[model samples]
Target: MKIILSTLNAKYVHHALALRYLSKSVPDARVMAFTINHTVESVCAELYKKITTDTLLGFSVYIWNVEMTLRVLARLKKVAPQLKILLGGPEVSYDPFETLTANTFVDYVIYGEGENTFKALCNANDCVSLHSIEGLAFRQDGQVIVNPPRPLIQDLDTIPSPYTSAELAAFEGKMLYYETSRGCPFTCSYCLSSTTHGVRFFSLDRVLADLRAMLDHRVGQVKFVDRTFNCSNVRTKAIVTFLIQNAAQTNFHFEIAAHLMDDALLALLKSAPTGLFQLEIGVQSTHAKTIQAIHRQTDFEKIATHVKALRQADNMHLHLDVIAGLPYEDYEAFQKTFNDVYALKPHALQLGFLKLLKGAAIRDFEGYTYCDCAPYEVLATPWLTHAQLLALKRMEDMVE
Candidate 1:
């Protein structure tokens, strides 16, 4: 048997990690992975030609894009009729039943976490009892069957590190990526990271081992993907101290909760070398009503002060973000957010529009209405109008 896991990740290094882990659990499974962005269709066709009858067997395709899933499935089916397809991730987990029923190409839908369920499906000898598998959805007797969800992985250290020495060696002096945690503690309504609803950190010793492995492989830069790297001040300080101790060999970056910073964190950050670290702070909006409406609690004044202090230190690069089309944020309100975040004068300002995904709080609210279009993004709200959204998008383009 053979299996293929594909993703639309911007980088090949991270995509290979998911593929490598899946391959390790499935015996004799020839696993091939591809990374495509805005080019899945053409890339799938190219890969189809490389597989012949002898090399091809039962295979599966993973869809992360709901908009492109049907089109890509149709293309893949024509190339390989025996291939089985699975849909998972945030895009499919939101509404699995409708997606599975509508698309004939998808054989199964894995909800929530996929690491264990994927291993089970690959090793199953009979497909009849597949419905008994937890965290999976499939069709049987013209009905959709959904199984119970698997518990979240508690011991993160047991999982193998995503980067390999050979892979890290490829980018000897360029880029490195690592994730120290799985989920976030905040409840920002617009973000999927908030859905997980708690903080889970990897073992400090395991994290140090991974960092040492990357450094030994000569990786110059490392980026932490934790949603809020500084949620636990103690852990944050320890990691920063580790980095500072190894500053001569590695440059580390983090995405942090700006309002959560304190004098202690500020002092440690100030002592780090310039260009050795970077911070990305997400200040979605400054308006109190807008912030409350989106279930995001932030102190704009304190955040501004902290950003100013970081800038004054002249040690690390800073990036800030703001979102348009959030509920209660009108054109004028968004302009204020833009001005406030921009005035901090970080390296860049990321102006984003609202995306309504499954399980988001704003999605359940009837007060705001969305456009019935392909992208399915929020079109208007009681406080924001359609015309205002279009105008604001234009302004965002101009400013960003």
Candidate 2:
């Protein structure tokens, strides 16, 4: 059987770690990655024509690529109806039955962390065998069958890096993704991280070795996919100290909570070699009501102080983020949020609009309306009018 793993990334420079993990789990299968913005049509055409009837194509779905992937799946089915299609990731995991029944082209969906489930699925003999695989959702005799959820991988280290020589060769001048840990400790309402229960760490030894390997290969950049890198101070310091001690040429980036930074953490980061570390901190909003509404915690004063302190080092590149169209954050309020984040003189200011993702708390809450698209971005809220939201979007574009 020819099993092919595919995904549509947000950009050409971005690489999806989920695809890599699934590929690593099934070493024999080939991986085909594509970007969402440009060449999507051409890519769909190419895959539809090149794939044979015997091929089994699996797509990694995301809020950004759900529509594009569906389009591709539809076209591919018309060309090769015998081809089997599989879907996975957080987007499909929430409503697998509806997705499977609504789209006949999708043969199956392996929800959640798919490394183990996907491995079992690829080895299945027939449709009957597919029923035995745990954590799967499929259609059997015109009825959708949703199997029990798969347990999270207790030992994250068991899943090896997807960085085979052939895989690494494909990302030559592109970005690389590394996960030092899984799950986030915080329960931010708008984030999917809340669904995850506990934090699990990869062995520090394994992480150091992986870091060394990436440094040896000298990839463009390695971005840690961990939701919150500094959630655990011990692990954070260990990893940071290793990077500082190793002192390689490759750049490492992480998304961390700025308010969580203590003097010790700041001291550790302040001494890093210039260009070795880049940090992205999500300061979603400055308004207290919005922050509380979204269940997001931030010590603005502490964050400002820590951020400014790190900037003096001239080594750390801090990227501060602000979200527009959030609860109780009107245009004027978002303007204040933007101005507040801007005052920090961050290397980059990421102005993001609120996306009411599936399973996020905002979806269950009231007072918001959003587009019914893949990235269900907020169209308007009681606090922020549609015109105000559009104005903020324009300002964000200009700021970027």
Candidate 3:
């Protein structure tokens, strides 16, 4: 099969990390990544001209690209009915009921961890029954059949290297992301990281090797995709120590729960050079009950103290996040939460509204109304009415 993986990225400099991973997962796969700013007609025209009967096009569906992807997909199915269209990635991975049935164009969906499953599905022969493929969901004879789930890859080193591939050199200067870990230690209901608990690490040797390759290639800042980059203090320290010891011109970004920062990480951060490390702290909601309702544990005192300490040290640039419309956080309460986080004087402060992601705790959650779209943003809840949410959005606009 002539397999190709693609997605419409939010911008030109932003490459789709999942698309690269999918392409790296299957050696035979080619990639066609584009930006969403372009019209669907232009993109579809270019893509439709290249489709061959033997081709299998797989899209790394995400919130930003789903609408655009569907538009192109509908046109592709009309123009080349014989071509196969495969869907994967977070947007379609969990509950594809709507995507599979509502859109007859999608031929197959490889749910969960897609690397191994996609390789296996592509290798399967036409004569093989759909039921035989694990982690696959398909429509057959007007009924959708979903295969048994595939567990997350315990050994992540098996996911091939996109850094070492010559084809990826074209993406230089476009921000790149590397995953050193998977899953999260905390169960924050509002986030998808809650789905997979515990932490899994890629071999330190493998990670260090990839970093060396990235640095040698002079690739720009590499952001670690690990949910909680500092979840394991020992592992985090080891990696930090290595980066400090083997100084490179490359900058690294991490999303760390600031409360988890230990004295060791603090000491390291105190002395690290400016712009070497950038940390993003998620202070979702400051209301005690709101935090508890989301099943997140945090020490605001420590977070503030450490964040201030780091800010004072002038070592790393800090970005902090706040979510509006969390449970128990009314408009007034949300303003308080915003004020609390905003007071930190972070280099960058993010104001994001709650999104009831398909598989997140808020999806079928009671007393909540969310947008009926790919992103499924929370419109309102028992705690906050739609008008209040809109007010909060306007407040967010003021600061952001």
Highest lDDT model number: 2
TM-score, one value per model:
0.89, 0.96, 0.96
Q: How close is candidate 3 to the true structure, as a TM-score?
A: 0.96
Give the root-mean-square deviation of each candidate in angstroms: 3.0, 1.7, 1.6
Q: Which 10 consecutive positions of candidate 3 have the poorest summed lDDT?
A: 165-174
Tens-digit per-residue lDDT, 286-359, candidate 1: 99998887888789898999999999998888889888888777778888888988899888788877877666
lDDT of 1: 0.74
What tens digits encode model 2's per-residue C-alpha lDDT throughout 230-346? 988778998899889988667889999988877888999999999999999999888999888888777898889988998899797889898887888887888898899899999
What residue runs in model 3 are displaced by over 4 Å at the alpha carbon?
Answer: 127-129, 165-173
| Whole-model Cα lDDT of every candidate shown, in order | 0.74, 0.86, 0.84
Better-scoring candidate (lDDT), 1 or 2 = 2
